[model samples]
Target: MKTSSFYVAFDEAHKPRGKIAGNYSHLKEFLDSQGFICQPYMEFPITRQNLSPYDILVIPCPDFAKFSTNEIDAIAQWVKEDGGGLLALSHAGGDKGRRSNLSELVEKFGLSFENDQVLDYSKNFGLENLPEVVNFSPPHPITEGITSLCFRAGCSLSTVGLNVVPVAISNEESDPFSTPLIVTAEVQEGRVVAIGSYEMFRNEIPGGFEQPGHQEFCSNIFQWLKTEYREKVKTGEIKPKVTIQEPTQNYDANGITANVGSQPSFISAKLNLSSHIVISDKSDLANLFHGLLDEVTVLKDQIKTVIETIVSSEEQILETQKATESAEAATPLELPPNIEPLPVPEPERLTEMPEKPKSMKDTKKKTDTHLPKTKTHQPQPIPDPLPMTKEEIEVELETLKNKLNSIENLKDLVESKYKNKSYTKAQYEKQIERLSNDLNRSLNRIKELEMQYTKGKK
Candidate 1:
């Protein structure tokens, strides 16, 4: 079980240089503790090749300069081809802080940032500017354990793509009835999360993550983004290079060279006239080449062995099939003979009955009394009627909702029973896994129905 670290790059070009703001030290510290290597993006004119090495690219409150057309194109292509993750953050009032244009980049993935800021006078933190968000969409991993979140001067966002989803939304009491502050979308093979307020991740900002559930939300975001890369690293899909500790010193060919000690100090040793053996040094070179050739020969032998093993396996498989066929042909199956109907026996005559004791006869007479027969009737079957389009959609939507509720209840029951010590750890885990799968299916069905309903309106 080997593990590897993922490289995370922050966009320094657009980072807020304000002494107090635009810094991601807190975010970096949290990610670092999770075994991620954080660094500033070095590519000036960002390209796909330059961004390939990093698993996630963080664009935090870009204020000074917006992503150029080329940079946007490269970033999109990089995410699509490299299967990387992206975290794009923007502040309140659209680009109020003179930030660079990010909509152009995110719009390519079907995400749009609203210009107006979302504020709730009643459900805010101290000041009306910082709105507390309590309304969250149903059971997403990102918002699984999260119940509430607070935003500072954050704008709203929306997406139209089927793969795009709103992670968190403002309550109906807010100015915008159902404003989505945070969103996530699947772009090709990559994942992108867009948060409206950069202040939420900042350290010293008022109404910052110090509020309840904010830190947990951030952790969820990190977990979702890095889950794939972490698995890849553990399975050795991505390898990190190992560096040597020896000092590397380069020497110049100044016509004169001196060895300070017996050990060679240069990363590569200089060839002095006295040390050089012109044509006679062929033996070492020949031996090195011969060793390489021997290695090649060994590889060829291994390949040949593998091919032979595969061929043998194929032959064995063919032989097994032939044997199975021969057995089936040799032992032909026969159908069972038809079963005969049993003969019905006739009843004995009453005149041949034997006499019984007075008490037994009296008891039998009392027990055997005559009864009247009743008639039987068959009911007609009812036919199913054709459902209206709207009625069908509603029925499906209700069914999905009911299934979702059932899953939730089952999940709660499992947790309660596990807590009560009714289930072992292994049993609890197995049940949880099955319930989670059911929950996911129910959510997907609900989303599909909602989409269909919206399209019907149009």
Candidate 2:
């Protein structure tokens, strides 16, 4: 019956700079009011081992640094096996500068976040920046009692799995025609929710949570998460006891019949002998019936006593066998006559082994008269090899190729940034110069390794 606990991660390399900027204190306080344990989860790169302690994990508005392959796999596995809840919040331009690579994590649960932003001028709040979301669809457990919400610079969600539910959508003014704002889904034994905006739960934003139905929407999300973990607890609790019905018997003047319950025991076994019985004489029928009833009662008690005795004897025999085994193991084995024990030599005798006739030591001593004495092996410092083997050279060549590819990607990103006016011309030139130097050095190394590999092959 304890409250649910949440671990909010803020250790992302590109998380918003200041507390007021990306902090979720408003959400934390609200969760606290609902009797939840909220704690900051700074120690991460979220793995399965560390995730077991929390009922729910919240990564609110992460950065462009994508989670490692192992981390993504761990989070997915933890959610499925531990029945953990996950909440991923992404901002506009997902995977772009200062934004998150949340798609890697969300895709595991069959959810996706679009790179473009959703702008609704007509249905938005007072400012165009705050896109109003009045289209709450499906009305799931997480979106219960939620009709309207205002999102600040949020993106859109897409469903890739049958289990995925579109919780909300943008209006007609959205950049892309009426897209999904929030997506929720179930994966294995767990639940997941992905929202396009993190700012909806932030405090002190102009008409953020102050807007109508914002707080209710936030409450419903956490409430559903908490209820999920609680339901799992209830399902795994001790099962109810089964009831056994009494045996029923029907009697006629001509014959008697007995009906046994489903779980047939000793009584049923006895009844198997005769389903029907007949009596010929009416004069002694009453006496015979009384005698038969008494006999059955005695027989039942005898059978119960016999079963208990057999069970007790079996347990006693098992314990006795275990004790005998332990005793035998503790005792040492007797030595065989064929295997003679070696005699313990005197202390002085133990210092030196007896020499055999014409031993290798005598031969070596004679040979040493003509041979030069050997010098001590003074270990020389071995230099590190450069692509010593063909395999090594091939691996280095592949690594260089990957580095070159990365450099090209960086160049493309730089161009994109310049076009977006995020970098000045001078800044762009300096970055390009550094990247060019790295690319040139990598290309040269790749050529050298290739030449060495060819020579080795020849």
**Clashing residue pairs, backbone N/CA/C < 3 A, model 2:** 63-100
Among these predictions, the greatest TM-score belongs to: 1
Spell out the clash pairs found in candidate 1: 63-99
Which parts of model 1 are misplaced by more than 4 Å? 1-3, 17-22, 96-99, 227-230, 233-458
lDDT of candidate 1 over 1-458, digit per residue (tens): 35355767676544332111123456666777877766655356777766766778888766546677989988887666566788888766566433458877888786767665677878988766688887778567778888777788677775544467887888755654355789988765678889888778666556665667777887788777764643564467865322111112222221011223222212232222223322324533552344345335433543454465557777888999999999988966555678555679899777867777786655444533566656678777766533337666787677667657766886787788789996679767866775676567567767877887787788
Worst 10 residues of 1 by lDDT: 247-256
Candidate 2 has a TM-score of 0.49
What is the lDDT, from 0 to 100, of the residue 96 in candidate 2?
64
The candidate that achieves the highest lDDT relative to the unseen native structure: 1
- lDDT of every model, 2 decimals: 0.64, 0.62
Task: Output candidate 2 Cα RMSD.
Answer: 27.7
Which tens-of-lDDT digit does each residue in 1-458 have in candidate 2? 22223433333322331121123556666666876656444334566766655667777766435577888888888777667788788776665623446788888886678775776667777766578777777768777777768877677766544367778877744544345788887776678889887767656665455567878887788766653543545354522111211112321221112222222122222122333444444622552354355345435544554465567777888999999999988959768989988899877744676776675555544435788888999999877544467765666577668657877987887778779886679767865775676677677767777788888888
Residue 279 of candidate 2: its Cα lDDT? 46
